[model samples]
Target: MSRRRVKPSLYISVDIEADGPIPGPYSMISLGAAVAGRQDAGGFTPADPEEHTFYRELRPISAEFDEQALAVSGLDRDRLCREGADPAAALSEFTAWVGEVSTGAQPVVCGYPVAFDWMFLYWYLIRFTGGSPFGHSGCMDMKTLYAAKAGLPLRAVAKGTMPRHLLSRRPHTHHALDDAVEQAELFANLMAWEGPGA
Candidate 1:
């Protein structure tokens, strides 16, 4: 009997900036993704995040906006409305990039707090590109991962609480791609870490 080969998982660190709280009501103004690494039986192999990345600023789909949310990203709604990439085209290009980068592996989207990012990314990908390259379950939450590894309550875990060694040196700039690349480094570091005891 032949043993089936296990495909490695290509961890893509993703981040998104939106105009409001939810997908249909709000708009995802910007999106970013970086290939964190690939993991097989041997373990994770870190990637050069800058070498494989994707980013797009999208036109708002709705007129509604949240002043506080927009302030965090520092993206001009008026400017995006006039010059941003079309959602369909941007998402299609992103899907293609995901496929190209994970040709022989399964693609997984990872984020500092994956829920928010996944919500927008999945919604946009399905709404614009008809489906998602990562599927429904291919997501990893770095925050939750840290919680489990550190034996701490999920709600108690925060970047400030984590050891400096486990945290990436990259600054958490709000620019989608900058944050994505920064979190990619964090994800790689988390994967290689053996918890507080180690």
Candidate 2:
């Protein structure tokens, strides 16, 4: 008798730079992602941050933006409006890339405090491409994972409070690609980590 086979989960670390807090009213100016790791029912293994990656900058969808948020990324909204790729084309390409890299596995988006990046990304993907590579629920938040795994309160969790060993050596630059790679590293570390003090 043949047994059923289950596909592994492909954890893609994603990061986004937006001009404002929310999507639609604002815009996701840039995006970056990397394959953090893969895990099946049996086991898990982390992937290199440099492999199977995607990055792009998109034209702003709205003129309104938060100057503070926009300042953090240092991306010129005017230049992006003129030079960035169309949101539809950019998101479509990203989804296509996700499709190609996640063959034989379910693509799951992973991010640090996914509350923000996932929000912008999912909205953009659905709004522009009519679908999301990561379904409505296919996301993992590293901060939440760490807090739960370490038996700590969500409010008490912060990069500073977490063990230094748990963090990526990479700095948290606001640049989408750089932060994505950093988040990918952190995801891998968290995946293999046993817990605090381990």
Candidate 3:
């Protein structure tokens, strides 16, 4: 009997809901990711993890949390303190989890507006781990890709133009996991439509 070999083309889609924009100055309240790859000949890749692989809230490092961001994400500071993990510990666990999921494959970490999420995560990972396993460069920003491919202005690619099913039914929620899933869904749809060559 021949053993079947797994061919993994893994990619990690990540999102971070932060207290504000500036990385070190602001705080990241929550983080989420959806790992995707084709299995065997045919199987559905999930946007949300079957077993909740990557999702975490972190205790705020700064004294101030952005009111607007908090309103959008609805993550109470008290709740974060009570439920979230320490920053360093969370990064370690997340990185370890990424290693497990990718299994030696350096999965692409993607985001809707990857600049914001990538900046915060890259800073956090470097601060905690001295460096990130995912290289410093090479992030896939869906917004930029869409703009370039669709020949649409960046402003036109707002939340409204993005597919509705991808986003939460509720109003604009800044929760990291929710946004990450939404972005991943959008990316999947785009790839399906354009057939990777695009």
> Which candidate number maximizes TM-score?
1
- Specify the highest-lDDT model's number: 1
Cα displacement (Å) at residue 46, model 3: 7.5
For residues 29-128, what per-residue lDDT tens digits would candidate 2 score against the true structure?
A: 9999999999999788899988788999999998999999999999999999999999999999999999999999999999989989999998988898
Query: How high is each candidate's TM-score?
Result: 0.98, 0.96, 0.79
lDDT, candidate 1, 24-129, per-residue tens: 9999999999999999989999999999999999999999999999999999999999999999999999999999999999999999999999999999999998
Selected candidate, larger TM-score, 1 vs 2: 1
By TM-score rank, best first, the candidates go 1, 2, 3
RMSD of each: 0.9, 1.5, 5.2
